[model samples]
Target: MYSMRMFLLFCVLCLMSSTGYSQLPGPPGPKGDPVNDGQHGAAGQLGPAGSPGRPRIPGLSGPAGPPGSAIFCGRGVSGQELETLKNSLAKLELVVNYDFVRRVGQKYFVSYKKRESFSRAVEFCSQRGLELALPQNEEENNILSQFFGDVYKTAWINVNTNKAEGNFEADMKNRPLTFTKWGEGQPDKSIQYTGCTMLSENAFWRVTQECFLNAYIICQM
Candidate 1:
């Protein structure tokens, strides 16, 4: 019985030793379930400002190339269309402040209500591709007079008599005033330095020294 008891004790001791040594942690148990996310880190300090970039260089233009294709140069509107426009001046837009334009024969007359000096009137008309109105015949002069006789008593005409005392000339064509429609007592030499002519209320041509006179101007082309 003594020997059997000793053998049983020895077996128990061996079993306990083997279990302790074999445990070891078992490869960490497959990494738990993954921890919660961590907070974000602070931003780093900004770097120093950089130097300005170099300016862009404009490239030199290349040599002139061959001549381009030829293009037709002619009037944009047809004769019929031009006639329609002339007859219907109120429909066409000649310029600002000119609501209606008059068409006599082949000429176009655009009247301006704003007053300006005769020289200024010429300049204004020239800038708009026109010149001061020059009535070619008695009929034209009478028509113009009738149109503005009541509205404006006197307006600047394209005639200038600076060359000679009684020798009047149309500044437009630089031709002598063949058909003179002088008022009852017109062409007085009182004021001949202004170099401008006026169409009196009676449609008569008169010489005035008031070139700086601000009167309505009629431009024609």
Candidate 2:
């Protein structure tokens, strides 16, 4: 019986030792190799476009610009200079159109070959910035007579009685005549219709009722 009990106690002791040894933690295993980074993934698809922004407001206007230069065609020309140019051009045109026949003092006389009525003669001279020939004195009359010579038998003068019977006046300015060389029986007050005057034979002034009588005209400037 004693041997059997001692054998039993030894068996119990061996079992407890085995259990304690199994329960003890063992030394850590060798450290694992560090993990390598994963390869990069492919890029994703692009997203949808965003909506448009609001419209912008307009700004205020700028100030006015500077004045223009007076220089024209590479030359400085003012308003007066332009007027002078126009006058020169008009004089040039007159020279081209009219025949310069005679000149007395500062006045120049020009004539047209075609005959016209007294009214038409006045208009013609007026359009050219001139007036119908009016003899202010005997000297001007003689000059005009010599100018007429044999070229024109009769010519319209600037004297007329259109305002009063036998009361001759300068047609242009309606002023009284300072000089008169009336032919005999001319400007007869009895002949009330004879209003306009003309230059006839010997440079004498004569009145006629025929205002439409076509006669040569002399223009003075």
Candidate 3:
């Protein structure tokens, strides 16, 4: 009976120690062996393309594309290119085509045998980087007039005298007429709004028609 009482006392003491008082944490255990790294997972399939985002401050515009090689009126084509043009026209079966090019002094002329309206002729020559021929002086005027021979009684030249009765200017050079070959009392202002000049069969020039009349074209380059 005494032993049993002693055992009871000892149990009570242990329960007090566990429940009534806080115990300190035990020392850390030695680290265990490291585990091998897991295998890398396969790359997931690319996510579906994201929806297009609204442009924020529009992305900088790309540089402008280079201009097309088509020739325009500003700067004349190089000699080599002109020669190439001449050759190409020569091979073409076009009647009185660009092959009928003539070089007088420093200027180049292309006379088309086919007659066209003043505006149409300008467009034709302009598309090819040429401008309607202009007579610089009496000499140029006579030469241009004679170039066409008697084929057409009249041919178109780049003479626009609209604003002023006698104020005429060349299309290509944009210069006033220092020398004119008006055939006695020419430029009959009573008829047309915009004067269209023509090289007469007599090798004289006169503003005889409106812009609509079809006449031989002579372009200068």
Best model number under TM-score: 2
lDDT-superior candidate, 1 or 2 = 2
Off by more than 4 A, model 3: 1-97, 149-151, 169-174
Candidate 2 local Cα displacement, residue 124, angstroms: 1.1
Residues 1-221, model 3: lDDT tens digits: 99999999899889879797646676899999999999999988888998999977868889999966546377768768878878656534332456466666776677756688888887887876667887777667766766665556677888774636444544434666666677777766475456777878787777754668878887776
Positional deviation of residue 208's Cα in model 1 after best superposition, in angstroms: 0.8
| lDDT of each residue in 1-221, candidate 1, tens digit only | 99999999898778879787643466655667888899999999999999999999999999999965433255466667766666556434564458446777877777756679888888888887677887888777876775564566777888865645334654646676667777765666565354578887778887777678887788876
Candidate number achieving the greatest lDDT relative to the actual structure: 2
lDDT sort, best first? 2, 1, 3
Query: Comparing candidate 1 with candidate 3, which one achieves the higher TM-score?
Result: 1
**Scored by CA lDDT, what does every candidate get?**
0.72, 0.78, 0.71
TM-score of every candidate relative to the true structure: 0.53, 0.56, 0.51
| lDDT score for residue 28 of model 1 | 56
Candidate 2 vs candidate 3, TM-score winner: 2
Ranked candidates, highest TM-score first: 2, 1, 3
Tell me the lDDT of model 2 at 16.
75
